[model samples]
Target chain A: MATTKTPSRLVLNGLLNENPIFRLALSMCPAVGISTTVMNGLMLGTAVLFVQVCSSCTIAAIKNYIHPRIRIPTYTLTIATWVTVIDLVLSAYAPEAYKAMGIFIKLIVAFAIITMRLEVFACKNTVAMSFWDGLGMGLGFMFGMVTLGFIRELLGMGTLLGHNVLGFRPLLFFALPLAGFFCVGFMMAIFNYVELVFNRRKKRRG
Target chain B: MARLRRITYLTLGFLLLAYLLVFSGCAGSQNRFIKKTSFRGTHSILITFAGPVDEEWATKASNYRVYEKPDPDIVLKISTIELSTNRQTVILHFEEPLNQNQPHMVTMRGIMTEGKSVGTAIVKVRKLYLGYLFSILIGAMLVQNFVFTKYLGLCVFFGTSQKRSTAVGMGVTFTIVIVASAMMSWFLYQFFLKPFHLDFLQIIVFIGLVSLSVQAVDTILRKVNPMLFKAFGVYLVLVIANCIILAVPLILADNEYNAAESLMLALGAGLGFLIALFLMSSVRERLELANVPPTYRGLPIAFVVAGLFALAFLGFSGMSIF
Candidate 1:
């Protein structure tokens, strides 16, 4: 295999091509759970970003030494360590978010994306590269989560981050998990459309 | 040699990390542990009746310091007993006291049990464990159900129900994921989240763990049996981010359930999810040939059907089988 250095591609793949919520569709627990409000989604996204990036970096650094037989347990141990630290800090300081997030926060330890990065990307890449990749993927997931949150919060409650943007009767169903299905469907359609447009324009220019 | 070195290094690294995590986690919370003794607070209730106290029953109850007064001014007695159903009723008895115009204080307590007790004697009342289990089973199946109330885990519920054969496979796949995820979450919460004081990180941790486990399983399945992976690939991936698997542990942790109860809950929830999926998929297959409106074809009609199911399930809320 030839060695390749392509940082931007890694970031782009995560942001759009393999977006966590839309494309790869990993990490939907908090995406659906907290997308009730823009602020809830934003804070949750940030927390996930921090954990994902940190865990990816550590996993990359130790990838070579991790045996195939025990790679999972090792990754879990590391992820658990970071999650515990974050959990403690949150309960002590931000108790409200902790309560609101409830088990979804704890559930993150089992999220497929963190392990997928370890097995697929971090295992092969340098630590620095892994960090960037993690950041991009984490942020991509956050973007989808927050966008879903914004739409649901705005339509369901006539507000954005609790601030009233328009005076209209709320579509209460938009706040529910079923709404997540509708939101993801529409978002994926838009993503598909944008990609189609961008490709067609590029082809014309070429 | 390379494999051995990797295994040894990885093992050491994991052990060291776990130790550091536990140590730092406990250190952060100086007032974490609180000791409790057995004899903290003990008390017994006494009941007085208008008639002579039942000697044999009173004698047995005296061990617990519980007693009966034959000439008491006030008391509560067991009025009705339904042993088969574990239901009982008590009546209050009050009489004019000897203080002429003053009212007297009397207390009567009924101790009910299924098995013979070393303490006070009373009518037999079947244990609540069975009752609790019945309620839990019913609750898991219908009321506060995985499908209707929580709205969790609809992805697999809908995705797996397209064909009967696919539904069975999906159900089995879901059950496995549920059991594995629940056990994993339970252990992680008890050992890591609680002890280490890293509770704030629960959402990320749970999601991360489930995601990783699913990924690992997918990898192993793909490598070992390409045919099996091909058959269940899409549905298996859907199960990874399923809300039910993640949500059950949250509910379990919130309720402060024991290990047994958590496992029961996981099983009940997995079964509940399977039930919903089977029902919806069968209906969809029939709907495929029906003359349907163009606008309300796929998802919208399914939502309406699900809403009706939810409404039907609401009838089971007040039922108490135990």
Candidate 2:
């Protein structure tokens, strides 16, 4: 984490090295729960991004005021406030999307990934650094969700973005909640393997 | 102190075991109990049985006859009975839908249940509120277990469920928090959101309520019961991220359950979480020794185990206490 001294490095670290969902394995609940469709994934990712950036900036701006003992609750308050703002905005601007993602949009409050970033990155870092870190981490999370959603939606329903690209639904099992777990499990395993290979190659080159 | 805690654990374990055994042993065919009857549309009548019905009899149109209550002349001929995928509900279609709001009388004569019980019931809306509550409890626990079936709270499920002791401790802590937060959210939504037209703010309100409840419990436990504080205080923070804690309130608001029903749902959900934790922890502790592939060892294997558990829980769906 300390290696991420530059703003761009922080963002890159969050994007690939410490990808919130795949690498860090944080926020798997929301990551897998609503990522059944790409649109769902994109919306949730955007909400997470907005909340992450705002909460991180808020925590960075007022790091000294919050006593260490009550920091978690305070951070949670900031995240919840941001979540509410995005939630209301989505409802006002995109009622249809809001309806589809209404129940879950509220649940971004409990995403372990957001709270984790605030504690680990936001409080210790400067506001600008926190913003970049939040952007990077949020993008990383968005990337994971979209990938999972792409896999599930494409294979489960045999459709891409609600379009019947395959001309037929295949393995409708992927739409079920249990299938979400399996997809995530396999995805995480693949992620681990790829990361291992990447580090091995890096070591050989070094 | 150790003995007391041991006894409590033993008793709770025994109760859970007995509940499961008794219910499973009684897994005979459900009695032909009429759960509900209502008008589906202008031309159809919906009949919902408490459990899976004998499809052969349910589909047979000759077994059912429908007529208006005030007069026998007004009879709606059953064109066909379309059974739902679950087979517990069958919608009776007609040439012309029953448009009148008057009460309708439907009768069945042949075998309708798995036990081959002769079906007989005066088509009426039975006030089975108590039965409804009981079903809600069972539904939440086994049929729709949040962790295994609904797939909520996996973070804590996989995280704290590594060891049996920690799993039990976390499960107990989660139960208290979910119940408290669910009730608070229910109250806040009913009084504030629904009344004042501020439903959009429920997520924020719920987060605040859950965090406050956890904080309140934290302060109280620290002062009032040091032993419990030591045991569960560590888990209090984890409860915040538990999807189950937040999901319960969202569900209650979606369903618009009354105070008593919400309480029952919360209590049942809490116990269900405990049951799921106990089951998973026991299996996982054994998996610790098993030979697993390198990549699938820690969490990947656990996810597969959870999927298997989900399949097992699916069997509980068709089951009925009646």
Highest TM-score scorer: 2
Instruction: Estimate candidate 2's alpha-carbon lDDT, on a 0 to 1 scale.
Output: 0.80
Q: Return model 1's CA RMSD, one decimal.
A: 13.3
Indicate the DockQ of the complex predicted as candidate 2. 0.53
CA deviation > 4 Å runs, candidate 1? A1-9, A196-206, B1-89, B92-128, B147-163, B176-250, B258-260, B280-322
Off by over 4 Å in 2: A1-3, A198-206, B1-126, B223-232, B318-322
lDDT of each: 0.62, 0.80
DockQ of each candidate, alpha-carbon based? 0.11, 0.53
Candidate that scores best on lDDT: 2
> Candidate 2, residues B172-263: lDDT per residue as tens digits?
66766777788889999999899999887787788889989988878876876677678657777888988888889989998888766676
Pairs of residues clashing in candidate 2:
B42-B97, B42-B98, B43-B97
Per-prediction interface RMSD? 5.7, 1.6
lDDT of 1 by residue, A1-206 (tens): 23544777777878888898766656654554567787778777877788889989998888888889867667766776777777777778999988887666665665667767777888788898998899888888888888999899888888887777887737977866546555665665566667678888999999
